[model samples]
Target: MSDRNPGMELDLEWVSRVRVNTQAVLKRAQQIQGRKLVKKQWEAAWLLRAVTCIDLTTLAGDDTPSNVHRLCLKATQPVRYDLLKELDMHDKGITTAAVCVYPSRVADAVKFLKAANSSLAVASVATGFPAGQTPLETRLEEVRLAVQDGAREIDIVINRTLALSAQWEALYQEIRQCREACGDAHMKTILAVGELGPFTTVYKASLVAMMAGSDFIKTSTGKETTNATYPVAVVMARAIRDYFLRTGHKVGFKPAGGIRTAKDSLVWLTLMKEELGDEWAEPHLFRLGASTLLADIERQIYHHVTGRYAAYQELPLA
Candidate 1:
């Protein structure tokens, strides 16, 4: 689990008064993605930083112990050894921040990491992930079960119905219960921004999750029709900034789903740098919930070092 924030109590008045400027957010998103373009060595460095912040994830119905073990091994050494040697990063002990899997696979991930004598954290999506339509008690029990199975991070999906209905108190109480069930594990609240309607709702949901003691506010669960857009990210990042300013606590931001390319990772890194300053760019504060993204990053890094693009067969399966 990442560091805990010990979030403040729910303030319905503050949440109700929160507002977002859609035009301003869209303009900022456009400028951020178009203006800054790092090339060559600087781009490679930024990609490397992004690699460290990735929560290498494998959440599928077909997930098994064998596949989860492979993912753990890949998480231990994300980039190839020869490539790292060429870049002089071989001795840096580069690895993904954590391995995110479904709640049922938490034990498998833990066992694999332990057998390898590695310290990689295992993150499990609990509390009826993606849709979060299950009963509250059942959801909380799911969180407890995942933690009992050795998961250090619990990714819980918020009840979008409550947020959409503007039931701030209910949403806050539900998330608080889930956080309590997490025990010592870090709780990442997925707002499922794609289904949360406008940017205003996204901003408000971000605040509500942070106020309810979420260690991280994630954008999506990778099951929505659309996920992790730049404008939504800007709103959520600013909300995190606002929360930090008012309460003296820094909440983390995660942009998951549809983030597949190395360039996409660079854009998110730039967003964190420009919106919340450089402190949010670190792995402890930022995480990219992605599966296939690592392969593209490895390909880019290989090209950066060897001046030759690597074929798909050359990179390890993510």
Candidate 2:
């Protein structure tokens, strides 16, 4: 884990005046989408880089130990050996950043990863993931239990009701409680920006979450009607930059949901490079929370290596 954001006293003053220029943010999103990596080798290289930042996740209701085992295996060997060999990147020890699963499946994920002798970190979604409607006590207990189950990272969902009602201090304190419950595990705060009202509210929530010691601020839970979007991402990226400038604390940004293509992954990396520079593009400072995204990326890589797209059964399921 990176140096934990030691957290600061909630600055109500900073949270109050936060406002986002909607049109500017929209325009920036368009620009990011319009960017394209020029050369085949350069595009392939960036896609490989994106592969290393994936938080390979399985958060479905039907998640089982067997499926989690498959997910872990895929995480360990995300790209096929032949493909990596074609790019001469096989020996670089490339792999997804982590394997994210439900709190109950934390033990299974840990067990499988260890059995494979793979060092990939195990992450668990806690504190009523996708819906932070549980009681505070319940949420805290959930976080503690996931840690006890051997999760090195904890993804917590912030209560949207508090932020929607302009409960800044309440939101900070609650996130603080969740951070305290995380112990040694890294805490990833999910703003669920789609449900958090407007872009301004998204910015405010990002600030509050970072101040409360979130190692990373995520965009969505993938369960919302709207998940990660570029416009909302611009707001969050600026908030990360603002916090870093003021406190010298470099927090991470993760845009989960709706990001499922290799091209989409490159655009996200571009946003990070453009907004926060190259350091944030590393696995420690950035993560792509995705499920099928890896598969499409591998397909793209396959095409890059062979000059033609692979058949449906050409690559193993991710």
Candidate 3:
């Protein structure tokens, strides 16, 4: 009887030990790296190509009536007539994609887009816009308004109040609500990672945005004095790659603000590709926020495609 009791106790202990070991193994297996090194490098190359083609310009032109009017008119023209003339003369080039304009004029801009040759996308700033402090209802309504106005994409600023306060649940809720509000439109959630303060905060915010149904996690709104940066994007991309590995969901990344020249775009694109891989190379996964980048990219592509030196200033202003 004594021997049997001892044997039973040993068996129970063994079972408990085995169970703990099994759980550890399972957990280890579940942790996967989202991006492979080779694929990461390939993505960097494509992103470079995409960024190089962006032409960035400020919505508000210099202090001149004609320039200001030109800016306003281009916001709704079929093509800048001046720009077309430049293209006709082979003096400038058109970018890989179209410019991103304000929500108020999206429909008019889309109306004038030469669909056959150039692609156009309207970028609407949503959810109380630059401040992002309004009631949820007001935020949703803003998104609706932009969509009705023919905006193909919506760029939303994250609730900085919630983020800064460490009210993650509220932050997540805001993103979810905003996503639902967007309907069919792709949602780009700006962490305003810069406003988030540190790398840890940025990383956490990145995770929050992705988990809450953000299609693309954007760096910042140009409204901020300091916009996107290298490390900010790097950390965001790393978080995205990790999230995909865990949930099988691929979230895109966009580094807006201050991306001026083709070279600037290329650097961010390369970083994205190298960090996230080919899955991030598409417009669905990547984008640059700039008004003037398109011209420089046009010049590069023109030189490559047509074998010539084309200056951006020579391109049509539309």
Order the candidates by lDDT, highest first — what do you get? 2, 1, 3
Check candidate 1 and list the clashing pairs.
Answer: none
lDDT of each: 0.93, 0.93, 0.61
lDDT of 3: 0.61
**Tens-digit lDDT track of model 2 for 1-318:** 567799899999999888789999999989988987646999899998999999999999999999999999999999999999999999999999999999999999999999999999999999988899999999999999999999999999999999999999999999999999999899999999889888999999999999999999999999999999988889999999999999999999998998998888999999999999999999999999999999999999999999999985888776
Pairs of colliding residues, candidate 2? none
Cα lDDT, model 2, residue 65: 97
Clashes (candidate 3)? 19
Relative to the true structure, candidate 2 has a C-alpha RMSD (angstroms) of: 0.8
Q: Per the 3 Å backbone cut-off, how many clashing residue pairs does candidate 2 have?
A: 0
C-alpha lDDT (0 to 100) for residue 251 of candidate 1: 90
Arranged by TM-score, best first: 2, 1, 3
Per-residue lDDT value at 2 in model 1: 41
TM-score against native, each model: 0.98, 0.99, 0.70
Best by lDDT: 2
